[model samples]
Target: MIINCGPLTGFTQARYVIHMSTGKRLVLFRLPSIDPTSSKPNEKEGWSYYAMEAECPHAGGPMADSLIDIEDSAYVASCPWHAYDFNVETGESSVGIKACTYPIDVRGDNVMLEFPAEDGLNVALSKIEPVSEKVKLKNARPSETPTAKQEDSGMARYLDDDATLCDWAVHILNTAHPEHKIELTTHLFAIFTEREASSSPMEIGRGTVTAPDQPPREKMLTVNPGAMPRTGRGGTLKSRIAMLHALANIELWAIDLAIDICVRFATFQTEKSSEQLPRAYFHDWLKVASDEAKHFSLLRTRLEEMGSHFGALPVHHSLWLSAQETAYDLRARISIIALVHEARGLDVNPMTIQKFRLSGDAESVEALEVIHHDEITHVTTGHRWLTWICNQEGTDPVQVFRSNVQKHFRGPLRGPFNEEARLEAGMDKRYYEEMPNVVAAS
Candidate 1:
């Protein structure tokens, strides 16, 4: 049961605390202190509302009484009971106890929270503006550069492949307007071809630019995995719109995720003979980002033809969850996202295409066909890189692949896979032949 607390009071006020109580549960304590750096581009200070459990795990002490580290950039909190420190931004406790942070979001001025619906836990907030209207992208491109203080307006900053692409991705993800993302992404890809992939020593300095990985969306509608609505092949028009929207969102996330692989990992490559990664790594992912942008465009166009817009329904950030989960190891990312997630797409696309075909939605079928074709490349790119990374570590590719599946991939690998497509994508049977107890591709 998610609950709305109220409008955050301290935007200009500097600091304010929101204590939500329903008799001893005293469950929520949200304090928003202005982050002075919020004015910087892509930095959304208010959105970083990190709220942890009310009581400290160490001694059941109320966390509301925790000390704030104003001097420190991470803005951590220290429990006074035993001096256990925690990064409030991440809820990471130095003492190793789960902080049990509740998920919350600030949309417009309204602050919302989600917790167990039990014990009559509910609070409403000030009125939220209706979700923003969609704006179509104008295809006109200026023939000459604008020297009027804006030559590099976001997408035009094609300075370096890794850095520019990363900047564009972050900008797209951070744009608060909730505009036509697919169209914006298509325009961004032109910038990719405009620049060369940088081999400038895996720039630890972002090659030139960088931005936080927060993906774009209106105030998020996040919920537990169990909370997602039950969706299937045959459903109402609303359900079909939802299903298509979910797919479109995955492609949207893939755009950032591919760029993330580029800018985040390229720094590891140096002149040292030990660095196994090469320029081709960035190239492969850039291509992946391009393909993803196309996939998004197709799906979004189809959605409009269906009389639905991109943000007409809710979407979860689960695909990006794979990205966040694998932020530490490139191998884990490939194993889970490509081998497990994209591979599942091979299994599911044909059935989806068949569904659209049955409904006489030729437009959807054609768009999905393009997606199906490109996903082969997407999966292949993941396979190629994971295998290379394995070889660099001097670990057996097959064995390491299995290890990653067990370690990072959450569920059993479902199949009835497109065996032909998987093979074309360079995913050999050994990676999934008997691993994780997958069912055979039907």
Candidate 2:
């Protein structure tokens, strides 16, 4: 049986997945231009194509987001989840495993894949429905720039000049679906980055926005902290999955927290201060929101691979509760959410990574490593902004951070801390070393 994947023009270095009715999946990839002296196959000497199973053999990692590169005269795709490389043509891996490959033929402008004929084979292409065409915002200021056309996911909602960064923040905050929230968060960040790189003016209308008290979450089970299940040391598969689900939930809330601080306090001006926050402040938090979205995506994918998923287990409302306590003060928000909660992550992530390592779950380890690296920069961003705000107020940032934690945070800081990572993020030991050392509630 043959299936027409799509036009060759639609293909790039990015991997695309093709689903078959036989419950099998194939990923299509376009090879880059290869050198003439390379030992590639004749049909694959120049720009070519190949199809392989969409799931990585290692941990069922999604290959559609794999990183493609040329190595040893061969095109290789590295699985995004664990960085396992596979030869595009042969599906051969250096780790003694092989992904199933299929035959492909390009006819004119179309790319086709061949599969074994079966008694009840179906090759109908899955239809992609479009997202809502436009999101109307009340009191939106008209701009000269026309709204960009909505594509596969209707990501064009905020591309026009009239939609302020605060507008986008509120939109994301109000989204209830997890996948849609992730998509919107990512697209908002991409649009912001593109505009910045081109030196285009991005409207950030402060004092005209009001973020939701709490972001909308769909059907997620929440329980008190004491009611949460024990995920013991990640020594068992169930325990590891529970740990990942908990982390995923945290990252989801973190995405909201990052974006929330942007618009929720967009109008904030300390006493004796007249200026609102600079654009760079919004940029930093948008990047943080984007990173949190990515971390949540990784953890969710890992959970599915392990036969469980987010929302499968009850989560604690402690994270969002903290967000609420600090909602009235930007300094308190930054102090508790970033400096305290995120800094606590910096302390605990290494041990979490080690737990996955001990269990031989390399895929989970790789995902956690990426989160750990990005979180260091997140803590750094929090510190940088906190200091900037304190400088404006003519107060010591350390004093302010300590004050906010003592006021808004529920319990004392605990340690067996990762001091090195904390220092690297500009969080000095003085920030927490002298804080009350009472044992934290479970």
Q: What is candidate 1's lDDT per residue for 1-442, written digit by digit as tens? A: 5566565553332123445444323333333333645642212443355556656666565455454543245656655334466766557776677666666666666556655555664653332222111223433234254122235344232233344555665565555443334444545554443332222333333445554666566665766667777666744666667778889878878877776777666555422346846645665666677667677766777789789887766678788877777777777777788878888898899998888788777877877887886777677778777767766666776777788777766667666768877876677788787666543232
Q: Write the per-residue lDDT of candidate 2 for residues 304-413, one digit (tens) a residue.
A: 88999778998887899888888888999899999999999999999999999999999999889888877877887788888888888899999999888777776689
Location of the lowest summed lDDT over 10 successive residues in candidate 2: 128-137
Minimal lDDT window, size 10, model 1: 127-136
- Quote the positional error of residue 167 for candidate 2 in Å: 0.8
Q: How close is candidate 2 to the true structure, as a TM-score?
A: 0.65
